[model samples]
Target: MAITKRGLVLGAAALTVSTAAIAGTGLHFFKGQALLQSDDSKQQVADADKDTSLQPMSMLSLQSFFNQSPKELVDEVWQIIDRTYVDGTFNQVDWKKVRNEYLKRPYKSNDEAYKAIREMVKKIGDPYTRFMDPQEFRNMKIDTSGELTGVGIQLAADEKTKKLTVIAPIEDSPAFTAGILSKDIILKIDGKSTEGMDVNKAVTLIRGPVGTPVKLTILRGTNQIDYAIKRARIEIHAVKSSEVQSPQGKIGYIRLVQFSANAPTDMQKAIKKLEDQQVAGYILDLRGNPGGLLYTSVDIARMWLSKGTIVSTKSRTGEQDREQANGRSLTNKPLVVLVDGGSASASEILSGALQDNRRAALIGTKTFGKGLVQSVRQVGKDSGLAVTIAKYYTPNERDINKNGITPDVEVKLTEAQGKALVANRDKVGTLEDPQFAKAVEVLGERIQAFRNQAPRAETKR
Candidate 1:
């Protein structure tokens, strides 16, 4: 939808404003980024006049603007996607017509607006680009912190089956305590069927204030189970570290669950502490890590790599932005990364960077293979839109969207063993976990080879 108020620039639409002209035009956006207009909304002003329902008056002065309407929300979502979707082609659909068609429709309620937003997003055929209601948006913000009030679990929609699937449950949270395994299909929430529910809607139904109760109906293989879990302030320690003695020497064991804003700082502390203990090498566990912030992943990648390209993002216009290490690595010791099918997004970024640069050996199954980058923007007064703004690639220029990164040594787990680890997360980094054991073995070889090259290493040298 072409919304022009004296040719006022909205998101980065292809109007006519230079980068300097958009210096101070914004409507109090998130983290202070001025979302601009893009070519998706580059329709002529005459198209806006054809709506008939909307007068020739500027969009800022519309009666609907003073009193919020569902139509207003619909146009806001339309504008954000038009400006930011990675594919300027809008997946080959006429972006301007889609916007014009949606803005022309009448929406009576917020639900109607949300429904229209979902329908409009479906045209792109990218599942990562979706809309979130007000409550769902707030919950997403809470997840950035290391704590939240909910039965901690990450959910996603299975692409092929379209089922509401569990990516992974946060360790020791209410959901994990109730034995929620990864890949379990959530059939219902509090007796409400989730046949066609989106992840945001399910998250809104599942999250509540601390000490509240919620029921979840899950489908695991051939059995349907019900779990009544109480909501609480689930503390998510993104980085968990300890020193484990191996034949190679003391090893730093660090498990990163989510790449939140605090991940870099926490990881630095772990690495520094392990270095003080003179650990020979490291084991970074990214198992069941549904990734968080994109920039956070880059920062962590730099901590392990003294010099290498971390990751790169290519926009619709073929402009690629690369993040590289600036020689500030925390340690230069050999490293082994643990990954599985749950390792996705930012997780893949860090692991892929390390693998591509030969900085670390990966031991586990293939990664989850989600390389798309989404930008979240505030829509209307309460809702938010997560639009896929770009697609990322590994340092080797490999696009791992559906095809995951193969581990240097694949340590596949049996269904029973996988379920057992899900049942008891405390046993994750121990020898009982087969992947960790393999990582230690592989790391021992690296360390031994590393020692052989030293001047007798002068012992600890």
Candidate 2:
């Protein structure tokens, strides 16, 4: 359908252009007479408008607006816009410009819509209000545990050089075995320079069919090194456990990467394995974990806490509420959860739940408090809005948004001090960041105290 007079008028007004009478143009617009006469067409337009309007605006009492007078709704919105966002920022935001530039054009397919939304959201310049379509949102739904095929390497963008640099290579992965080392700058991938390349693009370039070849040009120290790296299927373990018969007897250490689809199953398996080894306690490492799935966090927290609300969400409706976690728990052992500024979203949920329930002591630095829960709703074909639908409150009713969760025992990262690991030598793992040492110290002390009370063990044969 061609642009309707109304659309053109709106578009032109947004573009600040003079409008002309565009009657009988046979554009997509339904003329006033035609619109009122055709019941089916009227219903179609109404349905579309209703769909957009009926969506409960985040933290806004949208349901109440339905029964409210226009003056009331407008007043409420104005007040909300004023109170939440100062300086009339909403008025300054060109939503019509966004709609015209991004959504006005009819999409050919969902892929087109998805691409458009991504582009639009990128243009918004707010990293928080992202567009995560159904598929992408589904991926964000849980922290599953499983192995994924990709070249295994820890990458970081150099602050000064702005080049993709290898922080470390995963053991036994193609990058490690292929001689990629720390501080090796990746200049290009398959002839494309890594200069100004984002992590997503680099990841896309790095990930391909297993056994396929990817050529990389790197700067090793001052010398440039080119290597033909054959991409092999690399397995990423979300959960790894090590049993140590410490001074306090048996202690189990479980490191969790991200919350993935298989995380619960893998965590259950880890727990059973630790139980079989008769582990006395556990050290759960959540440091550097960028949260994945909400369910995964809740599931992991449920394993340790058997009690009140794990997390609660308040929707757009002041009355509408959702909560999760039943009072079923699997483990009641002495627990220490490690956290850092990198630990976000789902990680925050798990840590907060554990802390709120008194099930575990949080060690390390403060967590990355991203308490807002996003719900992806399909707004257009192949495009969805990953809108911040609600805020999650911990079991203790604390909402950790900008203010992150502080550890019970605040330990900095400088003590672990791997000199080669420090990308920024000046601020490299400063005492302000030495999280690992704190976690180890906290867990180790707890284990030692427990050991002092335990019966002396006989020498093993």
Cα lDDT, all candidates:
0.72, 0.53
Q: Cα deviation of 343 in candidate 2 (Å)? A: 2.3
**Per-residue lDDT of candidate 2, residues 181-293 (tens digit):** 54467899889988866444565577667788888888876788888887775555778777855555677878786565456767889988898988888889886565554
In candidate 1, where is summed lDDT lowest over 10 consecutive residues? 16-25
The window of 10 residues in a row where model 2 has the poorest summed lDDT is: 15-24
Best by lDDT: 1
Cα lDDT of model 2 overall?
0.53
Tens-digit lDDT string for candidate 1 (1-461): 11212121122211110000000011111111223222123332212112111113235424444466788788777776776678889889998998898998888899999888899888877666778776565554332336556787777777667788777777778888888877788999999999977777777788777788889999999999999999887677889999999998899999998775567788889999999999999999998887765666777898899998988878787745687998989898999999988787788989999999999999999987777766555566656666676778999999988787899999999988887887777878989999999999999999998888767435674
User: Candidate 1: misplaced stretches above 4 Å?
Assistant: 1-69, 109-111, 455-461
